[model samples]
Target: MRNQFVGKLVLVAAGIAVLLVLTPFAIVPAGHRGVLTTFGKPSPEVFDEGLHFRWPIAQSMHLVGVAIEKGEGEGDAASKDLQTVKTKVVINYHVRPDAVVAVYRDLGNQPGERIIVPAVHEAVKAVTARYTAEELISKRAIVRNDIVDALRERMARHGLVIDEFSIVSFNFSKTFDEAIEAKTTAEQLKMKAERDLQRIEVEAQQKIARAKAEAESLSLQRQQVTPELLRLRETENQAKAIEKWDGKLPATMAGGAVPFISLPAKQ
Candidate 1:
């Protein structure tokens, strides 16, 4: 009975030793960092992915992910023309692994909710106010870039890196949309009218050119009609009449007058 009791005591001591040996070691998962805190105070040393050792019951591990994350924000703002604008913003960001401890110490773990959201609103508002509503609609890329630049600098101070940022959407009043549509329609109509006018002008020019050519041809024909040509035409007509006539005089004459003075005195 004494030997059996000693063996049980030895087994109890071995179990306690095993527990002590394994308690200090922790396995930080993939894409995470282990932040160490001793006695409720944060330590400057940060642990990367994989196994790490810490004091039992004295040092605690807090895991934070350093992978890429997405954040969205929206807000109401006024344009440079005092038009009401509603904007939705989207951003991709990630925390710096080495600087995460700084993030936890300075800004705490809710950095995204607390920091990025407000920054997006402010940056969007500030950028939106600089451009007119029409300009905002036309130059959306410029607006997105401005917001990105502003947020990048702001978030970098808190250990958040901006990967990509964009202005997802911008909404304005119904009246503005109608006005744009009407303006586009009017411009198209004006262009059509101008094209019609140009076509008519070209047709008119072609007709004038044809008329001038006809007039030039008529003038050239008139210049060729000389007095000698008229006499030659009359002679040719007399010859054709003589050729077709029989070799005899006319039996009668017109009662009004004779074409020529007869040789009466000689008769």
Candidate 2:
């Protein structure tokens, strides 16, 4: 019985020794930081990714990720034009490595839900309210910048760093979409009408130019029509008829006299 009691005591001692040896060491995964706590009180000492040492059963290590994390959220707000705007944004964020203890203490394990989501919603709403629906679509870059800036400011206070912000989409009411389509069609028709009017004006001007050119040509010809020129033209016609006369007159004449044919003088 004495030997059995000694053996049982030895086993209990071995189990406690094993527990002490195993609980002192911790392995922090990559992209994570170890947050130490004692008696439920968090410590500011941060541990990098690797094996770390702590007091057995007296201190504990909690891991908080410092790696980039993606978050997406959707929200609805009214634009400056009083139009309903549904916006979706994607955000990349991470807790600052050095601020993990404070983060763990203040924000607990779910800082994403506690801080990031609400910040995104508020930022989107605040920025969207400053722009009209058309401007939100047309000036998307500006809108995104505004939202990111707002988020950075809001999250920075809580040690959450903003890496990137993106706008996925913006949806509007069906009536507004239809109105935009109708406006586009009307503008297209107006543009086409203006183009046709310009074409018609160009054609009319070309016709006027052609008419003026023809009138100028006729005026030049009339100016050159002298009596001498007329006589010269008539003499040329008579000479051409004589060349084909065959040196014979018509068989029958309107008068009983022979045809008076003029011959060119010897030169």
Candidate 3:
């Protein structure tokens, strides 16, 4: 009985030892790289997603995400025209899978706060200083490109790759906004005045055309009158009076002579 009990104790000890030995193995989740460290020193080799083993108590594994992540940052700056400008930007980035060890050794787990945020702030201020406040609103695409280019150059050395970038907002001073509005309104009023002037000119030209047409008609009528036309008109009038006289002169006359419409001499 004692021998059997001793063998069972050995088996239990062996099982516990096996469990202890297995504790050094770790499973790196998907989309992440395992960073190994020995004696608080980061390892040069990065472990890909899967099971990896390290010497127990002498090493540790840290997972660094290689997946794309979003970061947002805002900064206040002065434009080239000395206008106050507030800018916000969003960035998409990821750690180079192969550079996880170096990144971990240098930047640690908070690369977004340590590297990306400051880069965004710096890039925004630098680019904004080159453009006027109005240009920042008008040339938005160009400004965003400038900021992205600057951030790419700054972040690449730190093992962060800029995948995408965008300008979220650009705010200006109240006085500047009011000035732009006033300018737009004034331009609109000027355009309306030009259109009204053109209409008035067209209407005046139309009136002049009508007056000239009436004068031409009157001149034409006057030119048609002549001595022959006047004689013909008088003879037609005398013939009409004779037709209505019933072939007899009036019984009474203003003078002692027969009262009759004198016929015009034949022309």
Better lDDT candidate (1, 3): 3
**Which 10 consecutive positions of candidate 2 have the poorest summed lDDT?**
251-260
Question: What lDDT does candidate 3 reach at residue 238?
Answer: 97
| Candidate 3 lDDT | 0.90
**Model 2, CA-based lDDT:** 0.92
Candidate 3: deviation at residue 108, Å?
A: 1.7
Q: Model 2, 210: alpha-carbon shift in Å?
A: 2.5
Give the alpha carbon lDDT tens digit for every residue of 1-267 in model 3: 999999999999999987775587978999899998888899889899999888887888899999999988777999999999988888999999988987888887778988998889988999999999889988999999998888887798988899999999998889999998998899999999999999999999999999999999999989999999999999999999988887764766877766666699999
What is the per-residue lDDT of model 1 for residues 38-62, given as tens digits with 9 covering 90 to 100? 8778888889999888888888788
Per-residue alpha-carbon lDDT of candidate 2 for residues 1-267, written as tens digits (9 for 90 to 100): 999999999999999888865587888999999998887888878899999888877888899999999999898999999999999989999999988988899898677999999989998999999999999999999999999988887798888999988999999999999998998899999999999999999999999999999999999999999999999999999999998789865865677765676699999
My TM-score estimates for the predictions, one after another, are 0.71, 0.76, 0.69
Q: What is the TM-score (0 to 1) of candidate 2?
A: 0.76
**How far does residue 169 in candidate 3 sit from its true spot (Å)?**
1.2
Kindly indicate the candidate among 2 and 3 with the higher lDDT.
2
Point out the worst 10-residue segment of candidate 1 by lDDT: 258-267
Candidate 3 ranges beyond 4 A from true positions? 1-22, 198-267
What are the C-alpha RMSDs, in order, of all predicted structures?
9.2, 7.2, 8.8
